[model samples]
Target: MPLDRAKTLQDTMTQWRHQLHANPEIAFQEFDTAKFVADQLKSFGIEVQLGLATTGVVGVLSKGEGDCIALRADMDALEITEQNTFAHASKNPGKMHACGHDGHTAMLLGAAKILAESGTFRGTVVFIFQPAEEIEGGAEVMVREGLFEKFPIQEIYGLHNWPSMPAGQMAVGPGAMMAACDTFDIVVKGRGGHAAMPHLVVDPILASAHIVTAVQSLVSRWVSPHDSCVVSITKIQGGDTYNVIPDEVVLKGTARWFSPELGCEIEQALRKIIEGVGKSMGCDIQLIYDARYPPTINTPIEAQVSADVMASLVGETNVNRNPIPSMGAEDFAFMLGKRPGCYGWLGAGQSEDCPKLHNPHYDFNDDLLSLGAAYWVALSEHRLI
Candidate 1:
């Protein structure tokens, strides 16, 4: 197997991942990151292209050209400071690769190097190093700027590191693998007055409190009980002083669902909650709902093929054929919307101490570097065969 040969590149891949982790950049600002990826691709004699989505990079390796397939890796980091005191900890103070994007980038680069050096596959492989996948919509921008139109690709694939699952396990499904992302900003406006005079003020904060509890009912009451969805209020901004009541409360959070109808329903439910509660509390309400990503749904044929390919290396027992889809959203859904593809999860969790994605103490497991590279190589060969 081509992927089996990637074992030799494990150390090299780990070095690359560590370097990327040290210097983290967020969103479309992956200038240094893109250059590094392009340089590595060019060093391997692969064709490199830049500036698709400002800082996105594409590397093409072609042999006899039986078919063309794409493998994507996100290159952006998050806006969190590094807590790990390791040597390769993030150099940037306010930015960190908390979501294992460094690992993702390194693994794909490893696969590219192996494929280029061996020339064992007869098809073309497009390596996509996408910028701004951490909450920003770099994938959507790439699609809008003619990513599929530029490359003659039939099938594309993507993967993310999974800290919740065991390191050797893999998961991919035919239906929704990730949910659609809808972010909302809500403002509850009320009269400001003395804190001690409870009856004198309308109290937007109290109204906001009721709103938080009311929206939770949307999932069980409005949407189907069985559908996978989420309504979370992550941030609340309102009061500045301790003794005075605030005039308004701002609620910021996200809504997630597998289907478009459910996404719409969630938004409608939020509006209803805000309006119904605002009217009863004598407060003005405004909501801004931005649908960022569609659900990452896998076509049946592509999902089956990718799952089978992954099982070849990781074993059938470790492959999760019926794993529950995550409520967290993935922007790769935009890419899949344009092409036939599958997105899988490469398990990186080792023990109970393993931190989940976006956590301050999180780090990409270097052990999965070679395994991920192997999966990419195996996927290309099996799909293009």
Candidate 2:
């Protein structure tokens, strides 16, 4: 195919994207967005299911008897004010599709329309329009609600827009496309005393400074050189007055690693370092660790399937393998963990003028809409056939 039909699909998607971009909704509050998606799916004669994660919608299209494949797109906007001066800029104050989620939803909807019209594939294609991807774990909630069990999907696929890569290009890797994210808070308790009396009391602020320095050694000295990890102490709060030391000091930060085992090891090491340092300094310490998303590991077979489908649509030269893994996390890992699947990066463009993700000035590239739709359609037909 020459992707001619994809151009038509792109035109439809562009309108949908504009409407969505105009009426942006934040995580878990995508009621109108969900309704819009449901209505579109129903209009296309696809079976629709709603309310999996408050406002998530799933559309099912079946052609013949065979296994099923799932295509997912998140439908949540970020808590950012729109800085773009375009006519379709966000109307919702302090909410914008800076992550290109509007584009993702529109492209998936485009694929649904094409697949429903073509009716060339065997089995079913489940279109997942999920909510709350930026904050709460919507993907996690959907899996818990039996999304896969009800749909019985053999494989699932997700895609995100990458602004750094040139438009029309796609990137995929076999494993660890994104890192595991974990957050931590530490409170150090000590006696409060006047700053003038240096020996009178233990300063928790001093102890906290030591702990921060010690924690850095966990990644620098403990973790292997080849393995990737990040430990950043982003916040520290202690004394309010220069003359008096406070009774406690609080520290907040996050840890990231590419492997689950490595993440666990890092957590254990953090606890030991905090407690060991606090005890030695005659201060009590409390640590709170929250494990967020696990690393997104693409199964080999699924990765190959994604690469081949993308190559067929965009040509072999446009698909990239072995792209560097990102330290950031994605909730899509939850779905990929449950099923054999891969998540690929769709290039938006490579202009320095193009706004990066999460930036208020950023908008999903309308030019890539048809390209994404074509990839989705080709993947569905190829996999089902």
Instruction: Provide backbone clash counts, one per model.
Output: 0, 0
* Tens-digit lDDT track of model 2 for 30-79: 99999999999999999999989899999999987988999999999999
**Candidate maximizing lDDT:** 1
- Candidate 1 accuracy as lDDT: 0.91
Candidate 2, which ten residues in sequence have the lowest lDDT sum? 1-10
| Model 2: lDDT of residue 319 | 90
Which regions of candidate 2 fall more than 4 Å away from where they truly are? Answer: none
Estimate TM-scores for all models.
Answer: 0.96, 0.97
Worst 10 residues of 1 by lDDT: 1-10
- Candidate 1 local lDDT, 170-250, one digit each (tens): 999898999898899999999999999989999999999999998888777888877878889989999989889999999
